[model samples]
Target: MSFIRQNSKLVDEFWEKGIVESCPIYDMHGHMGEHYAIYFAAPNADEMVTLMRRANVAKLCFSHHFSLWATPHVGQAPALEAARKYPDILRFYCSINPHYPDQIKQDLAKVGEWIPYCVGLKFLPDYHKIPVSDPAYKPALDFAEALHLPILIHTWNGSPYDGPAVLRDVVPHYPHVTFMCAHCFNNNWTAAGELAKDYPNVYIELTSVPGTRGAIEKMVSICGSEKILYGTDMPWFDEHQGIGGVLAADISDDDIHNILHRNAEKILAPFL
Candidate 1:
């Protein structure tokens, strides 16, 4: 038997049954609603919850595509309704678009109304065409810091907006807020590892990282398991694919456990 199958019950259980009951997944990054540019197989709440059940996912924290792609008013409604309807399986991040300063202020003012369901804030700086460190994000960052909420930022390897360099400027300022670097600064593994090592409140999220062989193992080695989070970017990628990638990585079962759910649990404790 392989070392993983021998030492990790989760591996055997997942291999045989396709889901591990003992270690249910907590997908920290996800999206609801169809994208204007691309098609998604499971965009609606019902279909997503069904997939979550099949994958033994305990909870999924998501932002609506409309919120990111369309106006916040048009996008936040579906996310709110979905979380309201499926409280146990879903939580949402309030998407912030820096372009609409008035809307940003309006939304942040009403944040309390979305409480319990809106666990944190989501920033798509690359798409929004603004650097995360810009003053435009100040209100959202301030609110997140005050509430001690996690902020999921869509980071890429070389984007001027939400890349590692931009993150370096912003993460240090908000020491109280948890910054989940979605996609782990894609392809920039060294910088991602360094960010997690340097900032106690910063976490590297595994959205697109798993697709790169040896990335997860390298991250664990550099920053340890506690600073890494498991996120599928679901509807865009399947949960099983992400889970399989982590399971196949040459890391301890304990490391797998931390990436899959334990670390996420700790991040969500204050909100949920």
Candidate 2:
């Protein structure tokens, strides 16, 4: 770690000041309310904001857990309310549960009303038990493509629902939408890297990525820093730990900056 500090000024600054003012963090993947299966010490908007302030997080674009797991009618309110309450530091992704096509249609129709606060759409195909290429997600996909929205999809190594093969079929179709491969397709780095490299609009999101040693460095080597986006499943994961992992990686300060905020800022510019 000392070698990392010696080579990277950002790392040294973070070590000395707890947070680097020069490199503000923009968390692209996060969640709001508590999950039914897990316990969170700071799951609410207020608690999350407090944590963000301490970590020098510039913004956190999140989709509430309720919005992802529960029915749209019951889940969307919390995300919308949180974003409305903290417009400056917070933004939300409209979660689409493909399980209910009617709900998906209804939610996609109202997406415009949640604008500025709503940055894009989120899909948990793995949980929804539907492939990303399924017709059930077409309405939301069309909306995102039309608006050039960023869609964060929960991808895993070999998940039939949202795996690399399924994503390949879907990514090229919606060229306008920014596809954020959350968790970097989990353990399948090759597929994740290939997706980022093959598709200009596709990016590798570092949510659970940092936990695997050399993952960040490897991703940078594979797709370059510009194709990598910083993300932490906040409340579900520690913000400081996520940021620190990037700062401590065997990569340059410029790469760290890109992952932490630069790339995210570029992608979010149109919406903001």
lDDT of 2 at 28: 95
Clashes of each: 0, 0
Q: lDDT scores for all predictions?
A: 0.88, 0.89
| TM-scores for all predictions | 0.96, 0.97
lDDT of 2 by residue, 66-108 (tens): 8888865575789989999988889999999988888778788
Top-TM-score structure, candidate number: 2
Model 1: how far is 181 from its true place, Å?
0.2
For model 2 the TM-score comes to 0.97
Candidate 2: misplaced stretches above 4 Å? 1-4, 73-75
At residue 198, give the lDDT of candidate 2: 94
RMSD of 1: 1.6
